[model samples]
Target: MILANVTLSGCTGANSALCAGAGEGHLGGGSYRTSLTPTGNLIVAVCLGFIGTFGLTNNLLVLMLFCRYKMLRSPINLLLINISISDLLVCVLGTPFSFAASTQGRWLIGERGCMWYGFANSLFGIVSLISLAVLSYERYSTMMAPTEADSSNYYKVYLGIALSWVYSLVWTLPPLFGWSHYGPEGPGTTCSVDWTTRTANNISYIICLFVFCLVVPFLVIVFCYGKLLCAIRQVREINASVSRKREQHVLLMVMVMVICYLFCWLPYGIMALLATFGPPELVTPEASIIPSVLAKTSTVINPVIYVFMNKQFYSCFHALMCCETPRRGSSLKSSSKAIRAVTGPRRSNDFLFMVASLGQPAATVPQLGPSFEPTIDITKGPSSDINNPVVVSLVAHYDG
Candidate 1:
């Protein structure tokens, strides 16, 4: 009879709860079964699968590049490495469970599983945000005050990474400490923070997360980057030769990364805030699903951005993957030629002449001076010249 119902539900595009609750229906209310539908489960599976696969592959590529290339192992790249590691965790551990819950439309993994999933997801997300803030500050210091930027020591980088982990723990630890609970919601049966059941606790937690993770970090990044841009502009005005094109490229890259970050996570933040403070009727299943998907989307987009927008990262990744050696001789010659080409024929004459001279081999010539060996007695204080024979040795003898 249950098999018949499962088949019928599949045919009607019914919720996944039909299959998900087959064995675990004893734990929750029978009403939970209504949330399961075949169509919804399929959607969850497809979305999560796509996100998990792409995010994992991209982050893995980045990790390989960082490990293989010594040049890419800067302090800034370290932060990126940390971010990729966290994102990869989400892709491998968090997203698969989420997909399963969505398809099942019931808490098949149960209460324990829900808490673990939530903690992992929240931990990685928070870490990624903190890393972004660290990267912004690092760039600002390097560009605005090069001397002050000398503080980017090994200990300092380790400290920043430690702080990121601490921040993640602060947000993730609350639910486990009895401040919140997780459960199934909507027609998808996916588990999340039980905002509807424990409104105040959920509100408090989400507000804290927003303040620490989003609001404060966003402010820090914007302020630092803004000051950096202004400082660069000032230098450019003082001397036209002080062109900061490299710094500008980095700033643009950071801006694009932050903008993408905002797009991916903002909707989730808005939804969380609304669920907490807005009218209860606004927390519809359909509405909640939008943010859930957006949050997952954020994890997937970061790897793509890192791979495509970061030139150094892309080059390093290509070298690692393709096993291609960097061309030294050709690159140097080409670069010199380019400079000459840009500086016109007059400048090219001197530079090309230099290049030609460097291509010739060196030859050793014989010495042109006569040589004579010299001898000295222990008691002698001076010696005569061999060529002139005018000078005579002077000796002092002492009686013992």
Candidate 2:
């Protein structure tokens, strides 16, 4: 990803005559020299630095929020936790190398370093994609079947995470095994997969890898989230009391992350595809530069999008930052007060009215006793007269 412009001054051993007319001549009038100009290096550096700092800070905040807040430890949050971890990896490992490559316009790390860098980069990228895909599927299942999906299923999420890491390893291992080559680019070398060879075999392998690893996974993410949104709409229509606002917020965040992911990687995928099948001359430094910058950008943006956009995450983050422990007793007391307010004596009839309005077939008008007792048939359906004032008195007294 490094681009360097070199201007030779006074050639060394062979071409002394070329420097004769020049104002500043070399020792033998044949000295070899070069002038390196940084193109977009500062911009790349600033972007990498900003993204790295933000990603690390935000992701760590997310992790701490999940760890510190017991109430936030839901199955859905577990998926987010995985996403944060993957994002942190990208920020820590990928961004630094990107900054160096863009600024230096050369791969100072050498061949082995480049291989390891590529492996780590590919690994984290795969983890991010798979984690997002898994998150989408989790949302789909939760929206489609909430009662069927409980806290116990979170262990399956853990298993899926383990599987994702395994899958990522499968993709990253090939380069190290010599099945593929990854190293610094030409004369003014930079670290990247050595795709500039323009060989049919190399091109085909890259095209296949891009399609399977990046493109297909993105499509899966979109499809899964689309279904989840539809299911959410259906659920909200059926049960307006369910309050899907928080889930919708989460879905929007995931969608944004997915869209950003695609935008960042799409260029890289396209470049790789083009590099494989096209002429070598077409693989210009300028052509690859933007894609490199964009791909690096994706690594750093994930944490920011997740935290700032999510309210529950923000609240938990604030609680953690303030070093405030959750007060369970106070929360329980508040819950009790809320329940009483909803189901209290004066509201008994209101509750019954709501239940009856739900169109349950077994509703009936109950016979009131002299004591004004509200008899609720838990087995059958709500009683029509359950909303009577006397019944309300009975319900309040019974609850008290």
Candidate 3:
């Protein structure tokens, strides 16, 4: 709800001038303060402009790649696509408003616009976070139980995606209904869940939002990736053929996952907590805006880490960029040939090892051959005849 505009009392000079627009009420009972100079706001506007442009373009490319390639439409990738969709929505619905606001040095949109921005961003951000956690769990589970990981279980992934959106919506809706509120945040140019509000209504929501949406998802990603690393270690122990370089590569990937999760979210979470509970003025507008800026970086970072890093997706992206439409069939044939080369006589056992090492499939592994039995014993280890059909086809569904 739009609050009544009170005459500026405490703010002086530029803050007073910037807040002096017609019909502009200090969102959340006139709590917002602008410390950023006009030039500072312009810099922020430029940053957000770049973020929005790159974020929109990159995510759109991901969606386009998914749409253009039937091979890319695996169950695991569906979760990745869900993340891209959320990030894309953020770019479209959330970033533009903030960009425009920064250009003006204050929020141009009113209180309702603030609420919508806060709700939409929170909802989409939570969806992206939850989807990452779910994707990690899916990867871990698929690796653990190769037999059960098949195309028939696509419904489970769809269910996970639906549940992520529902879960995010549950958290984001409370603010709209007054469990908390949305209002102008740092520099008065952006709006978010009312972080500066020091009331039971707002603090409780911030705590819950921090713990569940940010902390919990981060923990899940860590736990899942840690388990994946442990599994890779076990494979290394069972088979000496696994090189230390491969182990290092797996470790690096895990580090990247953890680092990316932290890079995108930890600062934002810290700032929110500080704003909610820290001493007065501890989270200055300038300091608070840094985290908010860092948070926006996730929209660009997520797709690069989660989707573009995949081998199959990269190949399709390369084809798309080069306009190799006619060569698409030959490329698939080459992919098949490459799969056979990797799965060939001398190093068949290495196939499963490679999957475990890389934490994903190198290429789309084909389904079980007609002549091959579906059953394979994991007890025999990576060197088992399991590589014949079971492991190969099982890991096929492990696409990102």
Candidate 4:
């Protein structure tokens, strides 16, 4: 069986059946250059460069916003920070490498490097996917049971962040264990799971990956969002128009998220499945690229949906870029007061008495008694009589 290394220039030659001709090529590691047409190389490179740059810049901005502002320091924002980190890793580790490889029109990273690229790319992608699901659940928690969500027990969020990486490692590491392996796939220009291999182990690996990474996460997002919508509908006392508007707004956001997610991933998932399980010649290298680029473009789309959509986030980002204080910072406002209107007087506030009459002379009113009656002096009669009890105030009650 011939292991193929084909030139993309549409040529055939003696050195390689896939090579079209022999010529001096761009100086790579060695002098060997064959006829691989750089037909769409520049376009692919430009697009990839745009994606990498756009994703890197925006994701970094998101990370910075989350880190620099204390007001953003909530459980939901913490989850967002995890997401930003994952996407930044993708931009740093995967996107640039992929862009470079696409520019060269070949897999310049070679065999072992191919494995690393595939593994790291898959790892970050999985992490981002899981993070999105977690973000949705976090939103649902905040919207559905805000009091519980607000309470200080951040261990769950931290544990979730930790587990995302661990779960990614669980799937991506099996390649090293030889159950499934990474190698150059479509066009020999890129590397990924060796889909052409039809062994039981390879098939099993793909099945598990699809199930865990794609199916499970998809279901989690769906369930969380469904519950969120239901909770929104069940909310009482809100005006019908206001509730519908809220429901629609949330629905739009959810739809955008889900649609973009499927837009980026569905094609690739379908293509990968077809390439792995179908006839050997059914899917071609060039055809496989559509999904790859689409999937990587996800790094560009996520920040838009997650950050730019939020007006406050946009304001914070704008403030941050201008080297000014964050106008919409996360820090607690100093103007807030912990005012508890207790019925009984404490020594700290003993001097702050509620005087109800002007006829009262220089005298200290008696302290609160049973029923929280604040002893008042209505008239300047005998001090003892006046102190007996002038008037009692009614306690106020609030109801939702």
Candidate 5:
């Protein structure tokens, strides 16, 4: 949680009077030495405004798309729809208040308001993290263990989604229960975990939060994506061209999770840990606020990645928004047609691949023609009708 007021005061002779008592603001006697100028406040406002607006709009569109299209209902995409809900919560519950405060240059919401804001922020943020970890694991299992990936077991993800909310709520609610506390973090305009407090309870909560929420989730995401990549490589080793799309998709998944966690949450985690255990001066208000700002970027970045990277979602998005299918010559249309052809009318194979691909038939493959079999013998080489069938490139598409 972060909060601020009068940060728009520039160091001019006129503003000097306005800023005089501002620099002397206190959180437990530690002075607010952050040079929160009008420029900084404006920057914060603009960034928050853009992220808040665009993130909310896009995520809502995502949710609506999922709801509007019956075909979009799948276990994997259900995870994304859940994520859209979480992001929407963040936008509605957290962004407006922060944006108002940042623009107005003050924390108008009282102590109670601060707690609510912090609670919402932590709740939604943590849910997003856990949801993503679950998604990665789900994708991994669907790809590598096709047997258990059927719709019969897809109900498991919904149960996991409910538990994810509880998991986030469990950790975040301790503050309300007197195990820890919440308050304005940096500027006194936003609210969050009381990192400045050095106490047995607060420290314990912080450590446990870091371990369970950040560290554990981070490790899980890395492991799941890494394993998925290795699985695709195994496919490649058997049939080179058949695995390119799979490898790239898995690689991109790994990069998104790994990079987002490291950049968005790692700094905040480090600074929070330092606040508890390192030299007090090292975790300055200004320094700490940097990471906090970075973390908020994840809300905007996540949905964009999903829409741009996944062919299936983008198609649905395009169709929903534009009121028409992708143009016939468009790469997406070609990809869609190609994928449908590869898995064409082959219920058994498509069903198996559907589970493997997380219930989204989004992959594009080199058209293997009418002779294509639902059950190709992995033991046999390419047939004459499919002279270059072994050379046929396959894209492991994801519907999510």
Candidate 6:
């Protein structure tokens, strides 16, 4: 709880006034010194403000979408809501304080405030990471067992959600109990795990945190998605009904999510490790700021990639805002019936549910006119499942 008012070594000129005793770069209670100028502080403030505003807005909209649409309440999607809540909490409890401190060019809140900021952000962020891992595994398991009646049972989903939070708590609580510490981080405007403290107490915690929190979750995501892709490829070979374009779309979505997760978090993780294990001066205060900013940017990028890109959600969102009722179609029911008729009751259910998981049936799934009758397309050739009405319909539904 020691507050340092150490002066910067190279500060001069008008910037010197801002750097004057206890004026700037002075974390209220920490050993670290910030080398940021007033201009740097202003830039940090602007970034935090932008992230806070958009993150709050987007996450709230996602919450609203979940509440307004019954279809969105599927067991798997509940995990998405869990992620949004954590991101929203970061926007609410973490971002604003950092924004205010950045504007003032120092940590405004006292030692207790710094502790809370560090602990809360760590808790919420880890929860999001664990939840994403669980989400990927859930998607994989659900797809693999699509034939199971309770493949996506709420009990299992809720158990996963609870475990994610509990696991995050196990990692985050140690700092408070003195396994490590939370103190002013980059430029003295934010706070996090005491990366600069090279003591065994701090170093042990950082190593464990990196392994359990970052590396494990990332590996889980990669493995589950890899298997999911392989399974989809297998299904495509066995059933020509599956759309290649839709498979590509699913692959793109998976890649975007994984890439975004890595892009946002990897630098911050590497920086922390460097600060912990490398030479004392290896990571500059100015250099540390970028990774912190990138980590927070995840709060903004998540909703766009995870929820907004979903076609069913996109159409419903448009309908909700534009005051146009979403188009009605019995295609989903008929499609299911046709699939059941062809594959029989037991096997067809899995295919239908797999399609739903791949992507929900959009409003654009074609409706059959009363005069129309199901017919095999001879021109589609022997290899094409286009001859099967069920397969033809499935492709159209997926193309949405």
**Comparing 5 and 6 on lDDT, the stronger one:** 6
Candidate 6 collision pairs = none
- Arrange candidates by TM-score, descending: 3, 6, 5, 4, 1, 2
Cα displacement (angstroms), candidate 3, residue 298, comes to 0.5
Which residue ranges in model 1 land beyond 4 Å of their true spot? 1-37, 148-152, 185-189, 198-200, 239-251, 327-400
Task: Assess the local accuracy of residue 208 in candidate 2 as a C-alpha lDDT between 0 and 100.
Answer: 64
Q: How do the predictions measure up, each by TM-score?
A: 0.69, 0.67, 0.78, 0.73, 0.74, 0.76
lDDT of 2 by residue, 1-400 (tens): 2211112553333222222211122233322111123645566567677877877887887887777667666666676778788878878877776666556644445445656776777788778777777766665554333122445456878877887788788777776765556654322223456665555655565766787788777887788666645543443554444325524643675568677887888878777766666754466654566676677666556666644454456555555667776433222111001100012334444322222222222344344454343433221111122232111112323233
lDDT of 6 at 47: 90
Clashing pairs in 3: none
Model 6: worst 10 consecutive residues (lDDT sum): 331-340
lDDT scores in order: 0.56, 0.54, 0.69, 0.62, 0.64, 0.69
Give the lDDT of residue 40 in candidate 5: 77
User: What's the C-alpha lDDT at position 316 in model 4?
Assistant: 68
RMSD (Å) per prediction: 18.5, 12.2, 8.4, 13.6, 9.5, 9.0
- Candidate 2 local distance difference test against the native: 0.54
lDDT of 5 by residue, 1-400 (tens): 2222334344344334323434454332332332356777788788888889988888888887667766556667778877778988998999888788777766556657777888899999999999988887776655443122444355778887997899999999999889778776665445688875677988889889999999998888888767656655655665565556656755776687588778889888887888778764556544565677778877887787654455556666677678985432222121111211122223433322321222112333335455433332121111112221222223233233
Q: TM-score: which candidate is best?
A: 3
Candidate 3's C-alpha runs over 4 A off are 1-34, 146-148, 243-245, 325-400
Model 6, 1-400: lDDT tens per residue?
1112235674465224434533432443532234478888888889999999999999999999778876566676688889899999999999998888888766667667888999999999999999989988776665444232242358988999999999999999999998988877756778888887667887888899999999999999999878766655544655545446445756897899889999999999999988878876577777888999899998899888867775445655777899865433311111111221112223222222222112223332345554333231111111112222222312211221
**Candidate 3 at residue 311, lDDT?**
54
Residues 90-184, model 1: lDDT tens digits: 88878887676666655456546655776777788889888878867765655433122332356667778889999888877887776765445
Clashes of each: 11, 6, 0, 5, 11, 0
